[model samples]
Target: MNWQSIKEQLITFLKDEVKKTGLTKVTVGLSGGLDSAVVSVLCKEAFGENLKCVLLPSQYSSDGSIEHAKEVCEKFDISYEIVEIAPLVNAYLPNMEHNKLRIGNFSARMRMSVLYDISARDSSLVVGTSNKSELLLGYGTIFGDIACAINPIGELYKSDEFDFARFLEIPESILNKKPSADLWEGQSDEEELGYSYKELDDALKLLVDEKRTKEDLVKFGFNSELIELIDYRIKSNAFKGKLPTIAKIQWS
Candidate 1:
Protein backbone atom coordinates (compact mmCIF):
# COMPACT_ATOMS: atom_id res chain seq x y z
CA MET A 1 0.00 0.00 0.00
CA ASN A 2 3.01 2.28 -0.45
CA TRP A 3 3.33 2.78 3.28
CA GLN A 4 6.47 4.81 2.80
CA SER A 5 4.62 7.30 0.66
CA ILE A 6 1.62 7.29 3.00
CA LYS A 7 3.84 7.84 6.02
CA GLU A 8 5.62 10.73 4.36
CA GLN A 9 2.34 12.32 3.35
CA LEU A 10 0.95 11.96 6.86
CA ILE A 11 3.98 13.55 8.41
CA THR A 12 3.73 16.40 5.96
CA PHE A 13 0.04 16.78 6.68
CA LEU A 14 0.66 17.06 10.42
CA LYS A 15 3.39 19.63 9.92
CA ASP A 16 1.41 21.74 7.48
CA GLU A 17 -1.79 21.70 9.51
CA VAL A 18 -0.07 22.63 12.73
CA LYS A 19 1.83 25.34 10.94
CA LYS A 20 -1.45 26.89 9.89
CA THR A 21 -2.46 27.08 13.52
CA GLY A 22 0.70 29.07 14.32
CA LEU A 23 1.53 26.50 16.96
CA THR A 24 4.85 24.73 17.17
CA LYS A 25 3.71 22.17 19.73
CA VAL A 26 0.98 19.49 19.73
CA THR A 27 -0.55 17.00 22.18
CA VAL A 28 -2.02 13.52 21.79
CA GLY A 29 -3.90 11.24 24.17
CA LEU A 30 -1.71 8.17 23.97
CA SER A 31 -3.75 5.15 25.09
CA GLY A 32 -1.34 2.33 24.24
CA GLY A 33 -3.64 1.28 21.41
CA LEU A 34 -2.68 0.72 17.78
CA ASP A 35 -4.23 3.91 16.39
CA SER A 36 -2.80 6.16 19.11
CA ALA A 37 0.58 4.44 18.94
CA VAL A 38 0.81 4.99 15.20
CA VAL A 39 -0.33 8.58 15.59
CA SER A 40 2.30 9.18 18.28
CA VAL A 41 5.01 7.90 15.96
CA LEU A 42 3.80 10.14 13.17
CA CYS A 43 3.62 13.10 15.52
CA LYS A 44 7.09 12.40 16.84
CA GLU A 45 8.38 12.34 13.30
CA ALA A 46 6.53 15.53 12.48
CA PHE A 47 6.88 17.58 15.64
CA GLY A 48 9.90 15.93 17.19
CA GLU A 49 10.68 17.58 20.55
CA ASN A 50 7.62 19.77 20.23
CA LEU A 51 5.18 16.90 20.77
CA LYS A 52 3.87 15.83 24.16
CA CYS A 53 1.78 12.72 24.83
CA VAL A 54 -0.64 12.69 27.74
CA LEU A 55 -1.58 9.37 29.34
CA LEU A 56 -5.06 9.84 30.81
CA PRO A 57 -6.01 6.62 32.53
CA SER A 58 -8.98 5.94 34.79
CA GLN A 59 -9.65 3.40 37.54
CA TYR A 60 -10.94 1.01 34.94
CA SER A 61 -7.70 1.24 32.98
CA SER A 62 -5.48 -1.79 33.34
CA ASP A 63 -1.91 -1.38 34.55
CA GLY A 64 -0.71 -2.84 31.28
CA SER A 65 -2.31 0.06 29.45
CA ILE A 66 -0.24 2.64 31.30
CA GLU A 67 2.89 0.56 30.81
CA HIS A 68 2.26 0.13 27.12
CA ALA A 69 1.65 3.84 26.66
CA LYS A 70 4.79 4.72 28.55
CA GLU A 71 6.75 2.30 26.40
CA VAL A 72 5.81 4.23 23.26
CA CYS A 73 6.81 7.55 24.80
CA GLU A 74 10.12 6.37 26.29
CA LYS A 75 11.05 4.29 23.24
CA PHE A 76 10.46 7.21 20.93
CA ASP A 77 12.03 9.63 23.42
CA ILE A 78 8.86 11.66 23.26
CA SER A 79 7.88 13.77 26.29
CA TYR A 80 4.76 12.59 28.12
CA GLU A 81 2.57 13.24 31.15
CA ILE A 82 0.42 10.87 33.19
CA VAL A 83 -2.90 12.04 34.61
CA GLU A 84 -5.49 9.80 36.24
CA ILE A 85 -9.14 10.51 35.45
CA ALA A 86 -10.69 8.22 38.05
CA PRO A 87 -11.09 11.02 40.55
CA LEU A 88 -12.90 13.21 38.08
CA VAL A 89 -15.15 10.38 36.89
CA ASN A 90 -15.98 9.16 40.36
CA ALA A 91 -16.78 12.67 41.51
CA TYR A 92 -19.70 12.89 39.08
CA LEU A 93 -20.64 9.31 38.25
CA PRO A 94 -20.45 7.78 41.71
CA ASN A 95 -24.00 6.44 41.59
CA MET A 96 -24.33 5.78 37.87
CA GLU A 97 -24.44 2.03 38.28
CA HIS A 98 -23.98 -0.86 35.88
CA ASN A 99 -24.22 1.28 32.75
CA LYS A 100 -20.70 0.65 31.63
CA LEU A 101 -21.41 2.29 28.31
CA ARG A 102 -22.28 5.54 30.06
CA ILE A 103 -19.25 5.19 32.29
CA GLY A 104 -17.02 4.56 29.33
CA ASN A 105 -18.34 7.48 27.33
CA PHE A 106 -18.01 9.82 30.31
CA SER A 107 -14.50 8.60 30.89
CA ALA A 108 -13.65 9.31 27.28
CA ARG A 109 -15.06 12.81 27.57
CA MET A 110 -13.14 13.42 30.78
CA ARG A 111 -9.92 12.33 29.16
CA MET A 112 -10.51 14.65 26.25
CA SER A 113 -11.34 17.52 28.54
CA VAL A 114 -8.01 17.07 30.26
CA LEU A 115 -6.21 16.69 26.95
CA TYR A 116 -7.62 19.91 25.57
CA ASP A 117 -6.74 21.73 28.77
CA ILE A 118 -3.20 20.43 28.62
CA SER A 119 -2.88 21.47 25.00
CA ALA A 120 -4.05 24.93 25.91
CA ARG A 121 -1.71 25.15 28.87
CA ASP A 122 1.20 24.07 26.70
CA SER A 123 0.07 26.13 23.71
CA SER A 124 -0.24 23.04 21.54
CA LEU A 125 -2.85 21.64 19.24
CA VAL A 126 -4.62 18.38 20.06
CA VAL A 127 -3.81 15.70 17.51
CA GLY A 128 -6.51 13.15 16.83
CA THR A 129 -5.79 9.40 16.50
CA SER A 130 -9.08 7.97 15.32
CA ASN A 131 -8.80 5.74 12.23
CA LYS A 132 -11.20 5.72 9.29
CA SER A 133 -12.57 2.36 10.37
CA GLU A 134 -13.63 3.60 13.81
CA LEU A 135 -14.92 6.93 12.50
CA LEU A 136 -17.00 5.24 9.78
CA LEU A 137 -18.39 2.71 12.23
CA GLY A 138 -19.21 5.45 14.79
CA TYR A 139 -17.21 3.51 17.34
CA GLY A 140 -15.93 6.59 19.24
CA THR A 141 -17.58 9.07 21.55
CA ILE A 142 -18.27 12.55 20.20
CA PHE A 143 -16.30 15.45 21.74
CA GLY A 144 -14.14 12.81 23.27
CA ASP A 145 -11.78 10.53 21.39
CA ILE A 146 -13.19 11.90 18.18
CA ALA A 147 -12.25 15.51 18.95
CA CYS A 148 -8.94 16.87 17.66
CA ALA A 149 -7.43 19.94 16.11
CA ILE A 150 -5.88 17.80 13.39
CA ASN A 151 -6.08 14.09 12.58
CA PRO A 152 -3.13 12.50 10.81
CA ILE A 153 -4.49 8.97 10.81
CA GLY A 154 -8.17 9.70 10.17
CA GLU A 155 -8.00 8.33 6.63
CA LEU A 156 -6.15 5.10 7.32
CA TYR A 157 -8.23 2.04 8.04
CA LYS A 158 -7.54 0.03 11.20
CA SER A 159 -6.23 -2.94 9.22
CA ASP A 160 -3.93 -0.69 7.20
CA GLU A 161 -2.75 0.89 10.48
CA PHE A 162 -1.16 -2.43 11.47
CA ASP A 163 1.00 -2.20 8.37
CA PHE A 164 1.89 1.44 8.98
CA ALA A 165 2.55 0.66 12.61
CA ARG A 166 4.88 -2.16 11.64
CA PHE A 167 6.58 0.17 9.17
CA LEU A 168 7.27 2.54 12.04
CA GLU A 169 8.35 -0.38 14.29
CA ILE A 170 5.80 0.21 17.07
CA PRO A 171 6.33 -2.05 20.08
CA GLU A 172 5.38 -5.66 19.36
CA SER A 173 3.47 -5.75 22.63
CA ILE A 174 1.18 -2.97 21.37
CA LEU A 175 0.84 -4.47 17.91
CA ASN A 176 -0.09 -7.84 19.36
CA LYS A 177 -2.68 -6.63 21.85
CA LYS A 178 -6.40 -6.73 21.06
CA PRO A 179 -8.03 -3.43 20.07
CA SER A 180 -9.72 -1.70 22.99
CA ALA A 181 -10.60 1.84 24.01
CA ASP A 182 -9.50 0.90 27.52
CA LEU A 183 -12.52 2.71 28.89
CA TRP A 184 -13.42 -0.11 31.28
CA GLU A 185 -12.16 -3.45 32.45
CA GLY A 186 -12.56 -6.25 29.87
CA GLN A 187 -13.77 -3.89 27.15
CA SER A 188 -12.99 -4.90 23.59
CA ASP A 189 -13.72 -3.17 20.30
CA GLU A 190 -14.48 -6.35 18.39
CA GLU A 191 -16.58 -7.82 21.18
CA GLU A 192 -18.83 -4.76 21.22
CA LEU A 193 -18.88 -4.29 17.45
CA GLY A 194 -19.41 -8.01 16.82
CA TYR A 195 -16.73 -8.10 14.09
CA SER A 196 -12.99 -7.99 13.76
CA TYR A 197 -11.30 -4.90 12.34
CA LYS A 198 -10.36 -6.68 9.13
CA GLU A 199 -13.95 -7.68 8.58
CA LEU A 200 -15.21 -4.19 9.32
CA ASP A 201 -12.50 -2.47 7.26
CA ASP A 202 -13.11 -4.70 4.22
CA ALA A 203 -16.81 -3.98 4.32
CA LEU A 204 -16.28 -0.24 4.85
CA LYS A 205 -13.84 -0.06 1.97
CA LEU A 206 -16.49 -1.52 -0.29
CA LEU A 207 -19.41 0.44 1.11
CA VAL A 208 -17.83 3.87 1.61
CA ASP A 209 -14.71 4.08 -0.51
CA GLU A 210 -16.01 1.90 -3.34
CA LYS A 211 -19.62 3.13 -2.91
CA ARG A 212 -21.10 -0.35 -3.31
CA THR A 213 -24.74 -0.99 -2.54
CA LYS A 214 -25.79 -3.28 0.31
CA GLU A 215 -27.30 -5.68 -2.21
CA ASP A 216 -24.03 -5.67 -4.13
CA LEU A 217 -22.17 -6.35 -0.89
CA VAL A 218 -24.43 -9.30 -0.19
CA LYS A 219 -23.75 -10.59 -3.68
CA PHE A 220 -20.08 -10.16 -2.93
CA GLY A 221 -20.61 -12.70 -0.08
CA PHE A 222 -20.91 -10.30 2.88
CA ASN A 223 -23.43 -11.31 5.53
CA SER A 224 -26.66 -9.39 4.95
CA GLU A 225 -27.05 -8.53 8.61
CA LEU A 226 -23.49 -7.30 8.88
CA ILE A 227 -23.98 -5.04 5.93
CA GLU A 228 -27.24 -3.80 7.39
CA LEU A 229 -25.63 -3.08 10.75
CA ILE A 230 -22.76 -1.19 9.15
CA ASP A 231 -25.13 0.96 7.16
CA TYR A 232 -27.20 1.69 10.25
CA ARG A 233 -24.18 2.69 12.34
CA ILE A 234 -22.86 5.03 9.67
CA LYS A 235 -26.24 6.71 9.29
CA SER A 236 -27.02 6.96 12.98
CA ASN A 237 -23.70 8.37 14.11
CA ALA A 238 -23.09 10.52 11.05
CA PHE A 239 -23.61 13.57 13.23
CA LYS A 240 -20.63 12.75 15.37
CA GLY A 241 -18.29 13.12 12.41
CA LYS A 242 -19.52 16.61 11.56
CA LEU A 243 -19.81 20.09 13.05
CA PRO A 244 -22.85 20.96 15.07
CA THR A 245 -26.02 22.01 13.27
CA ILE A 246 -27.10 25.64 13.27
CA ALA A 247 -30.43 27.34 12.81
CA LYS A 248 -30.68 29.82 9.92
CA ILE A 249 -32.15 33.29 10.11
CA GLN A 250 -33.65 34.88 7.00
CA TRP A 251 -32.78 38.52 7.55
CA SER A 252 -31.43 39.97 4.37
Candidate 2:
Protein backbone atom coordinates (compact mmCIF):
# COMPACT_ATOMS: atom_id res chain seq x y z
CA MET A 1 0.00 0.00 0.00
CA ASN A 2 3.06 2.24 -0.14
CA TRP A 3 2.88 2.99 3.56
CA GLN A 4 5.77 5.43 3.35
CA SER A 5 3.84 7.46 0.80
CA ILE A 6 0.65 7.12 2.85
CA LYS A 7 2.47 8.34 5.93
CA GLU A 8 3.89 11.28 4.02
CA GLN A 9 0.45 12.19 2.71
CA LEU A 10 -1.01 11.88 6.20
CA ILE A 11 1.64 14.10 7.70
CA THR A 12 1.04 16.71 5.03
CA PHE A 13 -2.70 16.39 5.47
CA LEU A 14 -2.48 17.06 9.20
CA LYS A 15 -0.19 19.99 8.68
CA ASP A 16 -2.51 21.50 6.07
CA GLU A 17 -5.54 20.96 8.26
CA VAL A 18 -3.78 22.53 11.21
CA LYS A 19 -2.84 25.57 9.18
CA LYS A 20 -6.31 25.77 7.69
CA THR A 21 -7.89 25.70 11.11
CA GLY A 22 -5.26 28.03 12.50
CA LEU A 23 -4.81 25.64 15.39
CA THR A 24 -1.45 24.86 16.91
CA LYS A 25 -2.53 21.61 18.50
CA VAL A 26 -4.77 18.59 17.90
CA THR A 27 -6.82 16.61 20.42
CA VAL A 28 -8.01 13.00 19.89
CA GLY A 29 -10.07 10.43 21.74
CA LEU A 30 -7.82 7.41 22.27
CA SER A 31 -9.86 4.22 22.56
CA GLY A 32 -6.81 2.02 23.09
CA GLY A 33 -7.90 0.30 19.92
CA LEU A 34 -6.07 -0.20 16.62
CA ASP A 35 -7.63 2.75 14.78
CA SER A 36 -7.00 5.31 17.51
CA ALA A 37 -3.49 4.07 18.21
CA VAL A 38 -2.52 4.38 14.57
CA VAL A 39 -4.14 7.82 14.39
CA SER A 40 -2.38 8.93 17.58
CA VAL A 41 0.95 7.97 16.06
CA LEU A 42 0.16 9.86 12.86
CA CYS A 43 -0.88 12.93 14.84
CA LYS A 44 2.28 12.71 16.91
CA GLU A 45 4.44 12.56 13.81
CA ALA A 46 2.54 15.42 12.25
CA PHE A 47 2.35 17.80 15.18
CA GLY A 48 4.77 16.21 17.66
CA GLU A 49 4.07 17.24 21.23
CA ASN A 50 1.22 19.47 20.14
CA LEU A 51 -1.01 16.37 20.00
CA LYS A 52 -3.01 15.59 23.10
CA CYS A 53 -4.62 12.16 23.69
CA VAL A 54 -7.70 11.91 25.84
CA LEU A 55 -8.62 8.45 27.10
CA LEU A 56 -12.28 8.65 27.91
CA PRO A 57 -13.26 5.31 29.41
CA SER A 58 -16.87 4.54 30.10
CA GLN A 59 -18.41 1.83 32.27
CA TYR A 60 -18.34 -0.69 29.43
CA SER A 61 -14.70 0.09 28.67
CA SER A 62 -12.44 -2.70 29.72
CA ASP A 63 -9.36 -2.23 31.85
CA GLY A 64 -7.28 -3.61 29.01
CA SER A 65 -8.51 -0.87 26.70
CA ILE A 66 -7.57 1.84 29.19
CA GLU A 67 -4.18 0.32 29.89
CA HIS A 68 -3.42 -0.09 26.22
CA ALA A 69 -4.34 3.53 25.57
CA LYS A 70 -2.02 4.74 28.31
CA GLU A 71 0.74 2.51 27.05
CA VAL A 72 0.43 3.91 23.53
CA CYS A 73 0.60 7.48 24.88
CA GLU A 74 3.68 6.68 26.95
CA LYS A 75 5.39 4.89 24.07
CA PHE A 76 4.69 7.72 21.65
CA ASP A 77 5.90 10.28 24.23
CA ILE A 78 2.66 12.21 23.70
CA SER A 79 0.66 13.94 26.42
CA TYR A 80 -2.53 12.16 27.60
CA GLU A 81 -5.21 12.34 30.26
CA ILE A 82 -7.44 9.49 31.43
CA VAL A 83 -10.97 10.78 31.96
CA GLU A 84 -13.68 8.52 33.34
CA ILE A 85 -17.03 9.03 31.63
CA ALA A 86 -19.04 6.42 33.52
CA PRO A 87 -20.45 9.04 35.84
CA LEU A 88 -21.74 11.29 33.11
CA VAL A 89 -23.00 8.47 30.92
CA ASN A 90 -24.70 6.91 33.86
CA ALA A 91 -26.32 10.18 34.85
CA TYR A 92 -27.93 10.50 31.47
CA LEU A 93 -28.71 6.83 30.97
CA PRO A 94 -29.60 5.63 34.40
CA ASN A 95 -32.66 3.32 34.30
CA MET A 96 -32.29 3.32 30.57
CA GLU A 97 -32.37 -0.15 29.10
CA HIS A 98 -29.03 -1.91 29.42
CA ASN A 99 -28.85 -1.56 25.70
CA LYS A 100 -25.24 -2.01 24.73
CA LEU A 101 -25.71 0.03 21.62
CA ARG A 102 -27.19 2.93 23.53
CA ILE A 103 -24.51 2.80 26.21
CA GLY A 104 -21.79 2.63 23.60
CA ASN A 105 -23.24 5.49 21.57
CA PHE A 106 -23.57 7.60 24.68
CA SER A 107 -19.99 6.80 25.61
CA ALA A 108 -18.79 7.92 22.20
CA ARG A 109 -20.74 11.19 22.43
CA MET A 110 -19.43 11.89 25.92
CA ARG A 111 -15.84 11.22 24.93
CA MET A 112 -16.16 13.51 21.94
CA SER A 113 -17.67 16.14 24.17
CA VAL A 114 -14.66 15.98 26.47
CA LEU A 115 -12.23 16.05 23.58
CA TYR A 116 -14.02 18.96 21.92
CA ASP A 117 -14.08 20.86 25.20
CA ILE A 118 -10.35 20.36 25.55
CA SER A 119 -9.77 21.29 21.94
CA ALA A 120 -11.65 24.53 22.50
CA ARG A 121 -9.63 25.30 25.60
CA ASP A 122 -6.33 24.57 23.85
CA SER A 123 -7.31 26.02 20.46
CA SER A 124 -6.70 22.67 18.84
CA LEU A 125 -8.65 20.71 16.26
CA VAL A 126 -10.19 17.35 17.19
CA VAL A 127 -8.63 14.49 15.26
CA GLY A 128 -10.97 11.59 14.43
CA THR A 129 -9.98 7.93 14.81
CA SER A 130 -12.66 6.07 12.88
CA ASN A 131 -11.32 3.89 10.06
CA LYS A 132 -12.94 3.51 6.64
CA SER A 133 -14.64 0.22 7.42
CA GLU A 134 -16.71 1.61 10.27
CA LEU A 135 -17.51 4.69 8.25
CA LEU A 136 -18.72 2.53 5.36
CA LEU A 137 -20.82 0.28 7.56
CA GLY A 138 -22.48 3.10 9.49
CA TYR A 139 -20.94 1.55 12.60
CA GLY A 140 -20.18 4.84 14.32
CA THR A 141 -22.36 7.45 15.98
CA ILE A 142 -22.99 10.62 13.97
CA PHE A 143 -21.65 13.27 16.34
CA GLY A 144 -19.55 10.89 18.38
CA ASP A 145 -16.58 9.13 16.88
CA ILE A 146 -17.65 10.51 13.52
CA ALA A 147 -16.98 14.09 14.60
CA CYS A 148 -13.56 15.37 13.63
CA ALA A 149 -12.02 18.55 12.39
CA ILE A 150 -9.48 16.33 10.67
CA ASN A 151 -9.06 12.57 10.27
CA PRO A 152 -5.85 11.05 8.96
CA ILE A 153 -6.96 7.43 8.64
CA GLY A 154 -10.53 7.76 7.46
CA GLU A 155 -9.66 6.63 3.98
CA LEU A 156 -7.86 3.42 4.87
CA TYR A 157 -9.90 0.25 5.07
CA LYS A 158 -9.69 -1.90 8.19
CA SER A 159 -7.34 -4.29 6.38
CA ASP A 160 -5.14 -1.44 5.22
CA GLU A 161 -5.22 -0.05 8.72
CA PHE A 162 -3.60 -3.24 9.97
CA ASP A 163 -0.87 -3.06 7.36
CA PHE A 164 -0.15 0.62 8.06
CA ALA A 165 -0.26 -0.05 11.76
CA ARG A 166 2.39 -2.74 11.41
CA PHE A 167 4.62 -0.36 9.46
CA LEU A 168 4.20 2.22 12.22
CA GLU A 169 5.18 -0.31 14.91
CA ILE A 170 2.13 -0.08 17.15
CA PRO A 171 1.96 -2.40 20.19
CA GLU A 172 1.36 -6.08 19.46
CA SER A 173 -1.42 -6.39 22.01
CA ILE A 174 -3.46 -3.65 20.42
CA LEU A 175 -2.76 -5.01 16.97
CA ASN A 176 -3.89 -8.47 18.04
CA LYS A 177 -6.87 -7.62 20.23
CA LYS A 178 -10.39 -8.32 18.98
CA PRO A 179 -11.87 -5.15 17.48
CA SER A 180 -14.70 -3.57 19.46
CA ALA A 181 -16.33 -0.23 20.15
CA ASP A 182 -16.40 -1.07 23.86
CA LEU A 183 -20.03 -0.02 23.82
CA TRP A 184 -21.02 -3.09 25.76
CA GLU A 185 -19.39 -6.08 27.27
CA GLY A 186 -18.85 -9.08 24.95
CA GLN A 187 -19.67 -7.09 21.84
CA SER A 188 -17.27 -7.82 19.01
CA ASP A 189 -17.45 -5.74 15.86
CA GLU A 190 -17.54 -8.70 13.55
CA GLU A 191 -20.23 -10.43 15.57
CA GLU A 192 -22.45 -7.39 15.37
CA LEU A 193 -21.83 -7.01 11.66
CA GLY A 194 -22.47 -10.72 11.00
CA TYR A 195 -19.38 -11.16 8.84
CA SER A 196 -15.63 -11.25 9.04
CA TYR A 197 -13.61 -8.36 7.65
CA LYS A 198 -12.35 -10.57 4.86
CA GLU A 199 -15.91 -11.09 3.73
CA LEU A 200 -17.16 -7.60 4.48
CA ASP A 201 -14.31 -5.83 2.72
CA ASP A 202 -14.61 -8.07 -0.28
CA ALA A 203 -18.32 -7.39 -0.51
CA LEU A 204 -17.81 -3.67 0.02
CA LYS A 205 -15.10 -3.50 -2.60
CA LEU A 206 -17.33 -5.23 -5.11
CA LEU A 207 -20.44 -3.29 -4.17
CA VAL A 208 -19.30 0.23 -3.46
CA ASP A 209 -15.88 0.71 -5.02
CA GLU A 210 -16.50 -1.49 -8.04
CA LYS A 211 -20.19 -0.60 -8.53
CA ARG A 212 -21.28 -4.23 -8.58
CA THR A 213 -25.01 -4.93 -8.59
CA LYS A 214 -26.73 -7.66 -6.59
CA GLU A 215 -26.62 -10.03 -9.55
CA ASP A 216 -22.91 -9.45 -9.81
CA LEU A 217 -22.54 -10.07 -6.07
CA VAL A 218 -24.54 -13.30 -6.16
CA LYS A 219 -22.25 -14.61 -8.85
CA PHE A 220 -19.46 -13.87 -6.40
CA GLY A 221 -21.21 -16.15 -3.80
CA PHE A 222 -22.69 -13.34 -1.71
CA ASN A 223 -26.06 -14.20 -0.17
CA SER A 224 -28.75 -12.03 -1.70
CA GLU A 225 -30.27 -11.04 1.63
CA LEU A 226 -26.92 -9.92 3.05
CA ILE A 227 -26.22 -8.06 -0.15
CA GLU A 228 -29.54 -6.31 0.11
CA LEU A 229 -28.87 -5.38 3.74
CA ILE A 230 -25.47 -3.91 2.98
CA ASP A 231 -26.90 -2.05 0.02
CA TYR A 232 -29.55 -0.51 2.22
CA ARG A 233 -26.99 0.53 4.82
CA ILE A 234 -24.79 2.13 2.21
CA LYS A 235 -27.70 4.06 0.75
CA SER A 236 -29.26 5.03 4.06
CA ASN A 237 -26.08 6.15 5.74
CA ALA A 238 -24.97 8.45 2.94
CA PHE A 239 -25.69 11.35 5.23
CA LYS A 240 -22.96 10.28 7.62
CA GLY A 241 -20.34 10.70 4.94
CA LYS A 242 -21.50 14.10 3.74
CA LEU A 243 -21.60 17.63 5.04
CA PRO A 244 -25.02 18.87 6.07
CA THR A 245 -27.00 19.41 2.89
CA ILE A 246 -27.59 23.01 1.92
CA ALA A 247 -30.50 24.28 -0.14
CA LYS A 248 -29.58 26.80 -2.83
CA ILE A 249 -32.47 29.09 -3.42
CA GLN A 250 -31.08 31.62 -5.86
CA TRP A 251 -27.50 30.69 -6.53
CA SER A 252 -28.36 28.81 -9.66
Which candidate tops TM-score?
A: 1
Q: What is the TM-score (0 to 1) of candidate 2?
A: 0.94
lDDT of each structure? Answer: 0.93, 0.87
The C-alpha RMSD of each candidate to the native structure, in angstroms, is: 0.9, 1.9
Over the stretch 98-167, how does candidate 2's per-residue lDDT look in tens digits? Answer: 7767778888888889998999998899998888778888888999889998888888888768889999
lDDT of 1 by residue, 12-127 (tens): 99999999989999999999999989999999999899999999999999888999999999899999999989899999896778689999999999999999999989999999
Deviation of model 2 at 151, angstroms: 1.2
Model 1 misplaced regions, further than 4 Å:
none
- In model 2, residue pairs whose N, Cα or C atoms come closer than 3 Å (at least 3 residues apart or on different chains), thus clashing, are none
Winner by lDDT: 1
How far does residue 40 in candidate 1 sit from its true spot (Å)?
0.6
Please give each candidate's TM-score: 0.98, 0.94
Residue 120 CA displacement from its true place in model 2, Å = 0.7
